[model samples]
Structure formats: structure tokens, C-alpha cells
Target: MITIQDIRNAQENIQDTINATPILQSGQLSQLCRNQVFFKCEHLQKTGSFKIRGATNKVKQVVMEGAKLVTAASSGNHGQAVSFIAQQLGVPATIVVPTDVNPCKMNAIDAYDGNIVKCGTTSAERIPRAIEIAAEQNGLFIPPYDDPYIMAGQGTTGLEILEQVQDVDAVIVPIGGGGLISGILTAIKETNPNIKVYGVEPETANDTFLSFQNGRITSITPTSTIADGLRATQPGDMTFPVMQKYLDDLVLVTDEEIRRAFSVVMERMKQIIEPSSAVTVAALMNKKLPLEGKKVVTVISGGNVDLARISELMIGTERIY
Candidate 1:
């Protein structure tokens, strides 16, 4: 539903506010995968995630369209992005969160001055609630991943990666609701069809993988993967077609693998990447694909982990020897 030009326009629209997050080379990953590896560090973006890119674009559109307020259903990062951008634009935001929402993300939203509401724990529950609240208040509802404008804004990340990294042959992205990967796929394929785009997901939260295998959107029970940001129950309807058209492959990593990658990034790279951000590296560390002589980039989705849970994260995993 979005064109590359839409993405380019989004780039123009959000550039003023969003950081063109840096791409840093991972020498350890390069040795492990036998290829040059770089990280697109969206964890350093505004609101500590790339969600701001899309959130800024969507909220700006709504404001121009005369929306007095906005509502959204999010587990954490998207809510933070919406709340943060809305605050900057002098608009109010209501975030309907799941009962099991992460405290770190909730605190960020609250800090951004978002109106917080707790609803049922699933998107199936909170999504309807967000729409209902929008209707009740005559406000606009912003979907996390299933909208064209959101995808377009997210695609701007891919554009930056292309500019920052020369002749990249592949990119790996973490998939939650499929918005980020769908956007990256469009940006890469439209710019250079030869650059393969792959997606990684938590094994416990592999709804997008199931969707690809089943040739239709499939739902799963909510998972307890440490990668909370990757716990989407299903792929987006609008995003599915884009994956089918342009995506190269999908892979899954266990929570154990995710932990290993997380610790490695912290201890070696000295970067405190959240678990969801580690899935791409987990795929690489697990040698999920052939990359003996390729240039690859992994999109680190976000870095909003709850510090109170760091001990919990390292419980089952050992430090790198």
C-alpha cells in the first residue's frame, strides 16, 4: 500500500525530528559469520526506538488533518513513540496498554505525558478499545503496524542503511507486527532488488513465520519470550502482502539464543541492546544462513529493557568465554 516515494516523503517529513541513527560495524560478528556485519542502531533513535519515525509521520498527518487527539494500542515502544511525538506536537495521546505491559515502556509513556489506560492483555482486546476511545472522543486512532503511513515512515530506516553501508548484500530485521520488516523490504528491494531482506523472530513468538508457512495470517497464543517487543501474535494484514512479494526468508531463535546474543552485545560490543534487538544477532551467532563473504546489516529494533529485570535476563545464560 506504500510506495518508495511515500517512504522518501516520510524521510523528508521526519528528518527534522528523527535521528538518522548510526550504522556501526560489528567486528566480532564479522568474524563469527565470516562476513562484514554492521548494525543499524535504531535503539538510539528518538524515544529509544525506530517507532518514532512512523509515529512522528502519522501524528503529523493527523494534526494537519485537524485531529484534536490520538489513541493507540501498544505493549510499550510504540506507545512511547506516539506519546512522545504527540507531546512534541502539542497534541494529546491516549495509550491503551495490555494488562501485561512492560513497566519500562509504561514509565516512558507516562514520562511523555500520555493518557494511560489498561485494557485486556491482547491486541484483539486493546485495539478495539483504542478505536472505541477514538470514536468516543472524536479523535483519530493510530495503528501500530497495519497502516500505510506508518510503513512509509519506517521504510526511511532502510533508506538510511543503504546510504550508510556500501554494497550490502543482505539485511536481517526483527519482526513483531511486520511493519518494520515490511518497510525495510520495500526500501531495499525497490532500491536494489539483489539485496536480500530476511526477518528473525523469537521461536515462542513466531506468528509471522507461521503466516509465511501457512500462506495466510495465523494467530498464536501470547508468548513469554524475553524479547517482549517481538511478541506479536500475528503478522499485519497490510504487511503480509509486502513480505510475500519481497522478503527473502524468515528465521526463529530460542530465548536462550536471544540471551546469548544479548549478553554478547553487552559484554563485547559494550552496547546494552534489549532482547528483541538481539534476535538478528542471534540468527547470525546461530549461523542460520550462509554468509561466508557477504556484507550484512542487522537492524537493532529497540533498547527499552526494564533495568529491574536484568538479573532475570542473565539467569539462564552464561557470560561469553
Candidate 2:
């Protein structure tokens, strides 16, 4: 289990590399939800996502451990994050991504000067290949989630939330592999047990919710959603238990709802956000939680929406449903 102390240490380790992103009040969203809403603008962080917090901390620790290279598997955010950090530290990185992962994501990895290995079509397949490559080449494996160090690093986001919103009634986070929620829950509940944490996921990609009910990890049959960043097949071993212990609820949103949230963010908040980031907005817009009139904080996870995809989500005639 990761502790608050570990999170504090990570905050210090990666402070210079990562941004203390702004937390902005979303008046439009608040008016719509009839609640006080503050958006943690992590989408504006380095590499355009909060994943860098964990990836940088993980790679920095590995380099101190005398690892010559680092390996990782990601859908998009984590791959870009690890690659960027590895290059910054002058350490080599190899990223194994699912074959069907987005081309824009691949381009981002390519831009970071990281080695890319095309692997299986799911995170389940990609992770094993990362491990294999690490073993074959004597490199360290930087898991997207499931590692104590990674979890602790991600928890620093929660610490920031608490510091910014000491009287927060609820914190909403989007869930994929559960790292973000796990870290936030650990940090928030430790400081204020009264703060409620909600995990939001697409209805088509609700692996963590199912895992919470099953009392074990569960994999979803492969399905596609607009929120590709939240498309993990299952909950991670380390993240599952933390969520089960700390999360107040797991809510599901539809693809349409997610797109609407994307539009709301762009139009109302004047902020560019990706689908995965919009999951937090989607939950509030759909009233998935009982958060009327309460002070709520929503973690805007990323802002890496492909321009073409954004056009399609907002105005294109193609069916996203």
C-alpha cells in the first residue's frame, strides 16, 4: 500500500519537472449542476496529462536504482509521459502500445524520442511485452498503474486537491486502470475522512465498477468508446484494493454524455479537453452523483484530443453513438 508520506516525497521529486496546474472555478458547470465546481486543470500539465506525475517519478526512481533503460505500456497518456520523462533524464525508454491505439498517440510517443514497440491489441497484451522487453534488455518496467511508487506519485494530485479545496464535499475522478482514483482516495481520505470520492467511467468500459462488485479483478470484452483513454480492460491489482477501500461510488456515463461534456468544456469553460478528461464533466452534467449545492472538485485528466476527432465529436455528421 502507498502512504501519504510516499506521495509527499514524490511531490518533491517531480516538482520541478511537472506543473502545479491551476484549479479553476467552472461557473457554467456549477450553474448547470447547481453546485460549486472547481476543475483541477491537469490537462494543462506537462505532456498534456497528469500521467507524467507517476511516470516521471517512476523513471526517476528507476534511474537512481541504476536501471539503464525503462519500459512501459500505455494506451496513450502514459506512453507519452514515460517517453518525455525518460528523454529529459537522458535515460532510454521503450514503449509498447496496443496495435489499435490511436495514431495521434503514436505520433506523440514518436515526438518524445522514445522507442516504440507495436504490441497486442489490449493493455493485457501490451504489459507482458513491456516486461519481456525489460527482461531481455535489462531495463526497468514502469507500469501504468499497479506499482506502489506509481500509485504514490499519482497520489500527489490528491494532495494538491485537498490543499486547494479544504472544504470540498466530493471529488470526482475518471477511472480506467484506477491509478488516479486510487491515489486521490488515499490522499484525500487520509487528510479528511469526510471528503467523498467518486470514480466515473463510460458505461461501455466499466471494468473497475465490475471489479469492485466481483471482489477480484475482472476483464471486459474489448469494446470501443469515444473515451479511449479510459479503455483499460481491467482494474490493476494494487489499484483495485485501494478503490474498494476508499471510493464512495463508481458512476457510469454514456458516449453521448461524454461528448456533450467535451462540448461543455470547450464552449463554456473555454478549455480544450479530451474525451477522457470530459468524463469528470460528464458525470456532473448527467447528475450521476447526488452533488447538488455541494462544493465538488472534478479532475480534468487530460487535454490531448486529436483535432479531427474533436471536429467529429462536435460537428461532423458521422455517428459517434
The Cα local distance difference test for each model comes to 0.90, 0.88
Mark the regions of model 2 whose C-alpha exceeds 4 Å error after superposition.
315-321
Model 2 pairs whose backbones collide? none
lDDT for model 2 comes to 0.88
Which 10-residue window of candidate 2 scores lowest in summed lDDT? 312-321
Q: Global CA lDDT of candidate 1, please?
A: 0.90
lDDT of 2 at 119: 86
Clashes of each: 0, 0
Model 2 TM-score?
0.96
Question: How would you encode candidate 1's per-residue C-alpha lDDT over 1-321 as one tens digit per residue?
Answer: 788999999999999999999988767768876788899999999899999999999999999999999999998899999999999999999999988888989999999999999997777778899999999999999999999989999999999999999999999999999889889999889999999899999999999899999999999986778888877788999999999999899999999888888887876687877899999998988889766688999999899989898767763334443
